[model samples]
Target: MTNLSPSDKALVPFVSVDHMMQLVHSIGVEPILIGLADYIEADFKRWELFDKTPRIASHSSEGVIELMPTSDGEVYGFKYVNGHPKNTKEGLQTVTAFGLLADVANGYPVLLSEMTLLTALRTAATSALVAKYLAPKGSTTMAMIGNGAQSEFQSLAMKAIVGIDTVRLYDTDRAATRKAARNLAGMGLKVVECDSAEASMEGAQIITTCTADKQYATILTDNMIGSGVHINAIGGDCPGKTELAPAILERSDIFVEFPPQTRVEGEIQQMAEDHPVTELWQVMSGTAKGRTSADQITLFDSVGFAIEDFSALRYVRDHIKGTKFYHDLDLLADPDDPRDLFGMLKRATPA
Candidate 1:
């Protein structure tokens, strides 16, 4: 028996939660959001080249767990995410995730990273990226209708990527709104804590809803929304969860990530299966229209797609180079002789 060290092929770069936070801090949150938006936009432009599908989801009364997978022919990526809205009552995270990227050529993992923080970042980036195309010109104020774990990230991403200078916040829970207000302090945005959702929407050009109830709840009604505003509805990510009334869907020119997935899991789930909706990728690639009129209502039914996660993973993989934000994880077995895995294991043991 002989001692042997794992080869480079056996090592996968892993970004832990702490390292992710540090990486974010080192690069600055807004800059990372901007970079992620660029990556996501770039991928969306090449949307035709990647494999796409609805995420595989297992639904339970409490929440849903899902696996979102996609590949760009060269690199493959997947994310394991869970959404348990009730977990917050027990002081746990309502949403948490991890993801991996692998080489499609040899099926070896290239990167593994905690996606809880990254999910929040990517979700916000995706929202802002869509808003950039759909939101009205000279849009500077946003009405953020949900103030929970994702509130601050959404606000910052909008400011960083979409150039929103003011954020009006509202939530059912006053404390949550206050928390978001406090967290958003000194972030170079005018933070206004509102008493009601309607008040929050006043003078807002972009309205983003991200409530976390696992039921058919209407956080925004049709009357609450006016013309010439872009609605970013991200909270409705499962079959039973939604944020806007169906009438709002009817009034707005809806945009979605993937029609199949958004129909099953996004705000459009409330609409008829044949209801007209534009695929966002097509809009990004200039094949379709986005916010054609200043007075038209544009709605982005965001359910958080696999391609966005793939983009985030790709961004992290590219930026983490020449930095200490990740560690080499020995996650694979490499035998000197490819067919001698058993012999390699035996050699690893002491006589």
Candidate 2:
């Protein structure tokens, strides 16, 4: 094990962006996405075992920064991420991130990784994983409302995890829709571009809203959402940002990751403080109902919880086992004498 190698035992394995992309291509993006979904599902099945809490966020006029942390007794993980929707106009990505995994016993980070791509991967995987529990049977098409950075990943993830074979892409920016359509063309999924958001949902069984706006915008009104469909509401992930009309939230059975967190950041932020919602982990664990009737609507109000990031970190820590997809970063100080901290520093000065 690189983590146990004698000379490199103090080094932490770091997966860079190039390494991450290489690893994705090596394992295939679809399979890795599926793997991430499986890991997330497994973690959800044992939700009670994790020490869960809301992610801490620092909001700004143009963006937000967040630290998501979680632990499952044996290991701990955390991610540092930011969301800046206006950055797109400034020729920057809307989101960027990095994550770390540590041994809870020693509190030493075992793996550090570039999670910008992994966040996109895990978000899509989580959406598809929830759909497996809530979506209509034999779901094949998805209406992707926002065709920005996450659109293609969401399309491919649904195809790999939830049997989605077609995606209808819509965005206010035609270039984004075209880009999403172009990206998915070679991913074995049929992509259709639509002029309006309503047109995108015409025949789709699953509808995903992933706009990056940081304000209250009704991407889907009550009249637009039909029954027997699963809605993945991802963009309404902050206090003032919401995608669905309040009436749609009222009619749908909502599932969320953490109530305290989602109540502040998800679509439920539009509802009452006492509004009831099912936890997705409970639904996955069979302790709560996901979808009971054929004509009922189900909503997975996703706010990018910490447990999902933890699961992604866990999966990457394991999958890079025998591969050359990571670098051992000399991040920790290893002294010959455990108590000789000053001596260790002095030894490296001139010798």
Candidate 3:
């Protein structure tokens, strides 16, 4: 037996929660959000080059755990995420995730990262990116329903990417609304805490719903929504979980990330299986229409896609270079000889 050292291929860069926060603050949150949106938009432009599929989900009575994976012929990425709405009641996160990226050529991991914060950022960026295309021109105010862990990220992303200057917030829990308002106070946007969901929509051009219930519930009614407003519904992400009223879906021209997945997990699930929806990638690539008239209702039915997560992973991988925000983890078992893994383990043991 001899002493040996692992080579570069054995080391993978890892970004922890603390490192992720430092990276965001180092570049500024809004700028990070914008960068993420740019990466997502670029991927959508080349949407045909990547392998796409619905996230594999496991559902229990409490919530869901999902595996979202994708590859672009060269690199592969996947995220392990769980959504347990009841976790918040136990002083835990409603959602938490981690992800990995690998080189397709050799099947070696290049990066590993904590994705709970990244997911929030990417979700917000995706919403704002879609709004840039479908929202009515000159839209400045957004009605934000469900002021929970994701509220501030969504508001800041809209302000940074979509030019929204005002965010009117509402929540079933008044304390949550207050917390969001407090966090968003100095971020260059006018934060309004509303007593009711309807009050939050007053004079708002964009409405974003992001509640965290596992059951079917209507967070918005048909009469409550008027014309010319863009609805960014991101809360309903599983079967039997929805936010907007069926009448609202009937009245709006809906845009979605992936139709097969959205039809199973988004607001469109309430409608018929053949309900028409414009794939957002087609709109981004100029193959489909976005907002045709000022009076038209445009809805972005976002259910969080694997490609968007892949984009976020790519953004982090690119930005973390030459920075101390990541640590090299010896995640792979490498031996001098490819077939000597057992020998390497034996060498690692004390003689």
Candidate 4:
């Protein structure tokens, strides 16, 4: 017996890209990442609180599209994103995304925002957070493979979060690497353009792959990686896309965000069903170890999780409280009389 009428319920606000950027800039990237990491960890620790499911995907000849949905009893969220590798050639982004946040109690959307830029930010932040735990202590140099739209954020996040001051870069397309290097030019990071992946990884403590390939390709071979190197696998985040040689994962201590999802999408998908890999939450919660020895090879298989997007939406909504750029969207409708639903639609039009 609830007395409140459905029409009396409050509407959820919608946030836009301008609002999202303003919020991120206001909160600062480093602080936002720190907060997101904490939120992700807390959510993972209470795994039972969420109704989680693997992302829904629609594959096409060009690329694949995915919808990731999750809920934590009170709030519900989902992201709509597509991966089209040929996009860059057509001057379009390889990925375009938007997401929605809703109230689980009523299944009404509260916020909607573009997730393209936010995805890049959150992915890089997740990489750095994982590296902070798994990489060798005091590691200051990193090798970045596959410099693309994600490259700049990866460079900045590692610099701001993990003290990485130098980035050795390489890509099949040299211009992409140069573009990334140019973007980092006065950002206090020393950029070294290299001829190959091996050259890029030389003497580096962390290696991050952010390539946009849509198929299984070996960007890193076991021979190129030396001892004590942490690999942040960012791209190759789908079923057929893989960056590491199968053997590379075999030689490393692997970690992932969500095992059920990552098993089908992460770089470690090449491994067998029973292959041992630690979930990052375990390390964050002290239930498992991150880097036991400086010489151990560590790999963080990041396939991007729904929780990250949830964290980003929370950040945007909390920070864009008074912004006028975002307006109310009529995604749901309620009538004062349950039997007057058709009348409500007719009433919406002027007579």
Candidate 5:
């Protein structure tokens, strides 16, 4: 078999968060969403093509930190992210993430990026993609619960993909709601800053929950959500964290990215062991139905899957062209003599 030398391997491209943001900005959010959805759908259709594993999570008293890794033969990718709800109170983001992409052929890194921004983008894109199948046609207004960094991206992606025009926002912190409202101003979206979650849901066709609390909190009750509403559940992705009450899940048809993992993380974790839930890949592949009736409430339980991060990294690597901004890390050692492993390490470093 042909092999690559150390110097040859260092030439592989690397991308930082700033570079990735430039890439996303230059490519634009709508196009990125479309491209990511296509990649995710294509991979989903060939579900067996991937080397998948459930994410590894490190739980703390206050929150959780997770590592999600996956591969699709040619590429290996992993994201490092933490969920600390109390961080915002300390002037820190609730979530801060970074990820890397490597060539599986030689196990060389192709890119390294801050996934804090990319996560928001990918999660919103995944939400809109699910809504494309489940939300009623001509859906305009959306009620956004827990306005934070993710809220703006979610609103934009929904507008681009599913034709949402109005966003009614609510958060325990008024400033958070105001931030979301301000971000959407003049973007052709009518923003309503509501006092409570129920007020935000008034006459909304779509309900998006992206709150960042780490406890088992109920953001949506049976009384707030009505028929024909598509719920993009983004925040309640951990075992002890839930945004919707048990009755809400019992009444709605649930859709998830990956059922086995979602069963432990998504709102379905609150349901019975045998409770029915549909995998989104099946819906995209036409093996399952999305919404049966206009009055049916549909929920997309989003726990941020590795496949989504895989797709996002792939998109950035492919489209973020012509920038030589990445560093060359000496992650591997090369040797002309395969048997001299120790000698190769000695030669890898400078004298």
Candidate 6:
């Protein structure tokens, strides 16, 4: 690799998985989460200026593959992600992703980065950012249902953004809860393990569900949730996959990222076509109401929108400018002359 010639060295910045972990550790995860939250909020506040649409999904019995894309007219970003719930049984992550950011002016990629970790980070940041507007004032405890890869990140993001310092973790698999609890230790948050989802909700004002099962599941029943709680439902992200009971959706004030997208992919998909729901961006823009009462139930039906991936890509592009965490990838062919394609290839060929 060291013998790479400068003549063939037109390179794009590439962030590998190892480098992403290094970047997170170097800048600190909470600070990055806060920074990403700021970017996401900024984008939401100016939600009218972007080209928005629902993500394109291709589904199968095993899982789903999706392409989430967005543009602010200056920069465009998209993430390629897959969800295979059965992958865990074979010793692999249930979800994995990669993303790219490009300059709209030149139509050339500026950065390509591994988005598996970034997705988890931005998802947690999005939840916490929404909770800042929807959660009850002085909320300090969160019930982390479905303790898996996202549980620790969600717990930390809430602590950083909404001032929650205690997280009660629960999972159908006890080992997942133990894993979450272990990862959360020394992160300045008190972590608790519970035997069931209902037990985890004890004394918690915020409940986050992040299971990876690709089916209709009642992680929380109507009777399990009470008044004055904010629910961050992160599991039910595709059609035929939902985490809350229909009765719970009926009573809560639901909020979503995009109506057209959420109607088909989010928890709101379980409701009627006319079932009322508010867009979170409207709340951020002060055009609609958020948490109006301390006793009101608030639900953030997050389906992992494209704008978040855009924002996360932008954040990485900005912070990684001077860092050594990225490598140069020769992904594009650079010809000596724009029109002399034959000559450029002939020159590169060994005689």
What lDDT would each prediction earn against the true structure?
0.95, 0.92, 0.95, 0.83, 0.84, 0.92
Q: If scored against the real structure, what TM-score would every candidate get?
A: 0.98, 0.97, 0.99, 0.92, 0.92, 0.97
The TM-score measured for candidate 4 stands at 0.92
**Model 4: per-residue Cα lDDT over 1-351, one tens digit each:** 122333424455666677667767777766776666566556667665778788899999999899999888899989999999999898998998999888888777888888888888878877888888899989888999998998888888888778888999999999998899998888789999999988998879999988887889989888888888899989979989999998888889999888899999988788898899998878887888999998899999999988778877776666677766466665566676768778776766654
Model 3 lDDT, residue 239, Cα: 92
lDDT string for model 5 (312-349, tens) is 88877777565554545555555666587777666656
**Residue 36 lDDT, candidate 1, scale 0-100:** 97
Provide the RMSD of all predictions against the true structure, rounded to 1 decimal. 0.9, 2.5, 0.8, 3.2, 2.9, 2.3
Instruction: Look at candidate 6 and give me any clashing residue pairs.
Output: none
Candidate 2 residue lDDT tens string, 163-229: 9899999999999999888888777998899999999998999999999888899999999999899
Q: Cα lDDT of model 3 overall?
A: 0.95
Task: Give the winner by lDDT.
Answer: 3
Q: Could you give me the TM-score of model 6 versus the true structure?
A: 0.97
Model 3 agreement with the true structure over 19-49: per-residue lDDT tens digits: 9999999999999999999999999999999
Candidates in descending lDDT order: 3, 1, 2, 6, 5, 4
Clashing residue pairs, backbone N/CA/C < 3 A, model 2: none
Q: Residue 288 of model 5: what lDDT?
A: 90
Candidate 1 C-alpha RMSD relative to the actual structure: 0.9
Better of 3 and 6 by lDDT: 3
User: Stretches of candidate 4 above 4 Å error?
Assistant: 1-11
Give the lowest summed-lDDT range of ten residues in model 5.
Answer: 1-10
